[model samples]
Target: MARIKPQALLNQSKKKKGPSRISISTIVVCNLVVAVVVLSLVTTYRHWSQRSRNTLETQSQSHRFEDTNAASEQKSYDLPGYADINTSKGLITVELFKDASPEAVDRFLDLCQKDHFKGMPFHRVIKNYLVQAGHSQSSIPVEEWTSKGKLRGRLNTSPKHEAFMLGTPKTKGNNNKDFELLITTAPIPDLNDQLIVFGRVLKGEDVVQEIEEVDTDEHYQPKSQIGIISVILKREL
Candidate 1:
């Protein structure tokens, strides 16, 4: 049991406490550094995420606006230059030769727009010749069409011959006053100058053939009723 010096013992205790303090200080500094690094990383991630979300939202809004504008433009566009004749059999679309016969086209379009052709039967249908319609006397009996003197009065007795030529001005004699529309089933060169050829059948030629095949009397009047339901006129943009 040797006795230790007091100063030595005090020095030893001081050395032990110094190492403990150094260790504690080092641990506290390391923890602070780690906390600061973690906080910086979290802030950077939050900022990047916010920016990415905003960019996505902007892109989505731009696409929606473009689609809406395109749809609006499409809705505003007008139909192509054509007339739709909806008949009992099917729809017949005709493309008018505006350059060839402007007046005839105008008169026909006027009748169509006024709904004058609706419910009017194809009064005269001649197989391999022509199909005649637009007669106001459609509801009347076949004999009355000519016997009542209505047909005699409505005849274009002296139609303008110049009307057959392209770019010819419309004359009072060549106007469609009787509202008679003739669709030639075959190439009848003799009728070229007599009847107003404003439009040609673009679609539904089969329907024309069907109408021509219908049973008819000696007066060329359709035995079975065949009428136009409606007419839709469309102008090209």
Candidate 2:
């Protein structure tokens, strides 16, 4: 074999070096692309996880709030007695406490048994408060007379205004009478002693208020007739 020339040897060396340069550049570019892709995937996964957790927390908090509010408005009783009064305004239902005020409740039941309140007008009403009527012929007071049928004692008298007595509770020495109407509210001082507080308007207080708001004459008669078509009470045997 002839001795290899120096220029030929140099040319062979250049050819070998070209492949190494291309391989090194390719390796560096591939590593950079891989690093960028990995960082992007990590960022996206973290964002998605945080959003999911936030949504779950919000829904849980909303449910807790609604549960608390609903419980606050709910009312129930141990005794099982109810009165449903149908009036021109609408239906006004009441759940009474017979065990708490037995005598007064009995009096009310007696009147209901007699059909006493049928077709009676709601004689009185106060806004956001009560509508009252039970002025039957029997409720009218009898005048006093002597044994000879002559006017005796005071000579002239009026029916005892016991309508308010039912709205009142028992005092230090008195028992509350029965057969009247009342509704509850934030509580009032005058009502503390005078009203028997037989029952509350469980629903349809808006109708009560509507009756109260109607224009009244000097005697407190509503301009529009608001009457009790019927009164019903039910008790479990």
Candidate 3:
């Protein structure tokens, strides 16, 4: 120690310093790298979260639009329900009011659904008066109608049968069987409610007119064979 020079002491002092410049630089670089990695992680997380939020919002909007369309379509059609009576002439759709005549409507709908009126002729057609169909027999024998007290003379009432009325003549007796279906082109209320009025024409009045105008024999049977091909029951609009 007594022989040590000043330069040696200075060298010793440099060796004992807090840290080398290179070591401090290395620590600063490591810290910078760690900071950059943390910043990247934060930016990636933010971007993913934003994208997920946008996707969810788009799906929600699409669902709402679909629901709205479905509701609108349902509301536009089939108010109370009806039927399509297809004939050789054309389609005749009738909208039933069951509340007015429940039994008549029920029987008519059943017959139509079963195709009971298929190939039946509108045998009776009095121009601008009434058109009759939905029976296998051309006419309910005159005696049968008279015996049931439905001959349209017992009660001489006012008003010729109203236009476009779907009615069944109450010719069936105490057994309560449903009878012939007739649509009145003009008002003829003299039959004393002989026809159980039920439903009315909804569409195809022109077809009815065509059927009425066809040429007929002396017995009121159509010469051109205007018959019912089918009766399609349209329970909805």
Candidate 4:
């Protein structure tokens, strides 16, 4: 057997190992590109997930705030079995003494529910005395309210001097009058049994005071025309 030369032996080894298919530098570059792509995808996914979570949180907070405000409004302004009178000045809430003046209260509430008092001015306003309203026939001159019998025949009539004492039986008589209610600013003992005290102010007395302070004409009509805008009735809970 002939001895193989060194150069020939090296050539043979190179052939057996096959041709140089990939270089070290090429492998390193490919690995770096793959790593960069993976990093970019992870970063984009994280950013998108974070943005989605933030949007959901913001929407949830907004819904919660709206719900809280709605609940607050319901609790603040809605009391069952009370009358809320919307006037030009502001809201006035009154609690009717139904037990004492059942007929009178019922009549007044019925008129309110029917919107009969809307746009009716306080026909008679006496300073430091009482504020009287519910005159539906306010278009005519104040002097003609009674003489024309405008407010005389429309409401339930209770006998004059009907007793409205808490424990006493309701008085028997024709006392019901139409669209004429009084809110006394001061104590008027003489009016206790004489007039039907159907309801008293529970809130917004300041608005009533403002009404009383309005300038009035010689006939006790509000010069600026203070009127009832609307009336809402809530049942007592």
Q: What lDDT would each prediction earn against the true structure?
A: 0.66, 0.57, 0.72, 0.66
- 1-237: candidate 1 lDDT, tens digit per residue: 998999999999998888543588888999999999999999999999999999999998998899898886554334235777788988877777665666666666667778878887888876766677765433334443234343433544332222112111123464344666566665544433345566777788888888889999998889999988998887741
Across 49-167, the per-residue lDDT of candidate 3 in tens digits comes to 99999999999899889888878656434333577778888998887766677677777766766677778778788776679885555334534332433444465543324688788
Cα miss at 24, model 4 (Å)?
Answer: 99
Clash statistics: count for each candidate: 0, 7, 8, 13
Instruction: Order the numbered candidates by TM-score, best leading.
Output: 3, 1, 4, 2
Which candidate wins on lDDT?
Answer: 3
- In model 3, state the lDDT of residue 51: 96
**Candidate 4 Cα RMSD (Å):** 15.7
**Tens-place lDDT digits, model 2, residues 73-100:** 3422333467777888787776665756
Better of 1 and 3 by TM-score: 3
Query: Can you write out model 4's per-residue Cα lDDT over 89-181, one digit (the tens) per residue?
Result: 999888776656666766666676677777867777766656777654323343432332444334444433222111111334533334465
The candidate 3 region of ten consecutive residues with least summed lDDT is 142-151
Q: Which of candidates 1 and 3 is the stronger one according to lDDT?
A: 3
Deviating ranges (above 4 Å) for candidate 1: 1-80, 136-177
Show the colliding residue pairs in model 1. Answer: none
Error of 1 at 117 (Å): 1.0
lDDT of 2 at 47: 94
Q: What is the TM-score of each candidate against the true structure?
A: 0.50, 0.46, 0.55, 0.49
lDDT of 3 at 163: 80
